[model samples]
Target: MPSLSPSSGQSGLSGRTPPSPSEALTVYVVDDEELIRTSLQGLLRSMQLDVRTFGSAEEFLAAPKVAGPACLVLDVRLRGESGLAFQQSLAHRGLAHLPVIIMTGHGDVAMTVQAMKAGARDFLEKPFRQQEMIDAVIGALEADTRRLAAERSLDELRSCWADLTPREREVLGHVAAGRMNKQIAGDMGIAEITAKIHRGQGMRKMRSRSVADLVLKMQALDVIRRAA
Candidate 1:
């Protein structure tokens, strides 16, 4: 069966606009069948997604890396090394973050469950509906986009935290924990005014406008645990 067989009624990837260059999404298709790879590539490209096709898992791993949000569309049965095994090995290959959508002509409940458990975002049977494939690709891309964004935010937060003085960090933590300036000062054996200075400095460095904002940022950075 063809990897992507557009049903007669389906028009095209409707109502979907390509993301901005800065937020471009990519999809890598791995199917041993040249026809399947070509078909899937054409369909995904119509949506303006960056599509790459590989004949085998090794070829995919050896390909020059494209940095940014992307997902893989893998067939369960490949020429060598089954897709499920490849999915399980992704973490070791530095692709743990890559989302995968598994498709196969010889699928079963057991296969679907195995794929899902291995972190496949979606499972499709061969000759799948074009719209179904489109939806799965879109969903995978969106998930990867969110993951990249969250990682970026976390990195920025860590950089900001790294810039704070040790004293400032201590005062900020206490402040985020709802400690008053005097209490923080007493705990640190410093003057209340000194504690206030450190708190203000830390808040500015963290770009937090208030105690609540500081608390939220700290919680996101895991500098302070969330309240039970």
Candidate 2:
């Protein structure tokens, strides 16, 4: 196994701010070599990042899930299962959302292409510079953070959608489709004032500031679709 000790090079993480415990991020390292694991653990811990090490892919999978955003730093070669195969199996293992950084002692252009195709966030050759590893981990964490935020936003939007009454949804849909209140009332066979009331309530429930905003949210929720 290639030694990835950070002591040999300057670390860029020293002056960075660490996240609080509640919002802490994690980095999982899966490598068969004990020295590599220990070195990485020490280096990341100095920066106050939560780091976990596993000897094999199976070990990491069997471990309990950690809360908050995290990324995986995986060695390409392992005793039991190669990192390439494990990376490909992440989606099947229900870890498709997890970002991965691939590292190898022996790397080739073909191997790098394969890892990228497998959705790895980065690839590093062994004996790589310490700053390179740190940069990759930081990039992966940033990407995961954006992904989690989008997921949460979608969930909240879905919850808001579920709270809407059927009539309210219909009114909102008409508005999204560019119908006026009178037109909506005609479409739903309801009074114009009733249509206006439902439109107001629906917009309030969806927390929309304007008709255009409502339309955008509706599109996001698939309440309306643009022409192909």
Candidate 3:
């Protein structure tokens, strides 16, 4: 896996600010057993990982969070909530993008299936090798980073779309739907030349380099709904 640390000299060369410690990847552990929590926390800290441990699902949920790439190392059984069920609850509350790795002492095939179906990124039985946990945690964090980046891109696409003029927006929709300039002008009750101008302006404002690119950006904004 790639290192989470910012590359050396990147900030110097690009004049961008370096990432702070709070932006480093974190591993959040939630297990009811005090010994287990401390032991795992010690292990992760030894690896230079930022680790936070909670005694229960409710406690973990209530804790203030850091904004960065992170994953939950969750044990299956808790004081008041089962990990699998809590996974479902996370999805219900729109926090499902948070990755979870389930660990348990009494896991079975059915439980494994349920956890996976409920959105667990990985599972490990108690007493597993340390390397296994480390690898799973790294993979889970990467998955979450990708999800967050996608959402950020979608938000930016929506913002750019919001800046289009009404006529430019209409021409964009037509072009995205594969309408020719002449056909778009006929349908929109404008001359072909005027339609061409609006189409060029829309493409520039949308920052799209091709019809395919424009289509994808607009799709991210659900512009098809407005076009329909």
Q: Would you list the C-alpha lDDT of every candidate in the order shown?
A: 0.88, 0.87, 0.80
Candidate 1, residues 35-79, lDDT tens digits: the string is 999889988898889999999999999998677889999988987
Scored by lDDT, model 1 comes in at 0.88
Point out where model 2 deviates above 4 Å: 5-11, 14-22
lDDT of 3 by residue, 39-132 (tens): 7787667556789999998888898786777889998888888877887799776577789999998899999999998889898887776666
Could you tell me which residue pairs clash in candidate 2? none
Error of 1 at 194 (Å): 1.3
In model 2, how large is the Cα lDDT of residue 90?
96
Instruction: Give the least accurate 10-residue stretch of model 1, judged by summed lDDT.
Output: 12-21
Candidate 2 per-residue C-alpha lDDT over 1-228 given as tens digits, one digit per residue, 9 for 90 to 100: 446645343545553444343568899999999989988888777767899999999899999877688999999999988999999999999999999999999999999999999999899998876667887887788788888888888888999999999999999989988899999999999999999999999999999989888877877888778657
> What is the TM-score ranking, best to worst?
1, 2, 3
Model 3 stretches with alpha carbons more than 4 Å out: 1-22, 225-228
State every prediction's TM-score relative to the real structure.
0.94, 0.93, 0.82
Please give the clash total of every predicted structure, in order.
0, 0, 0
Of the candidates numbered 1 and 3, which has the greater lDDT value?
1
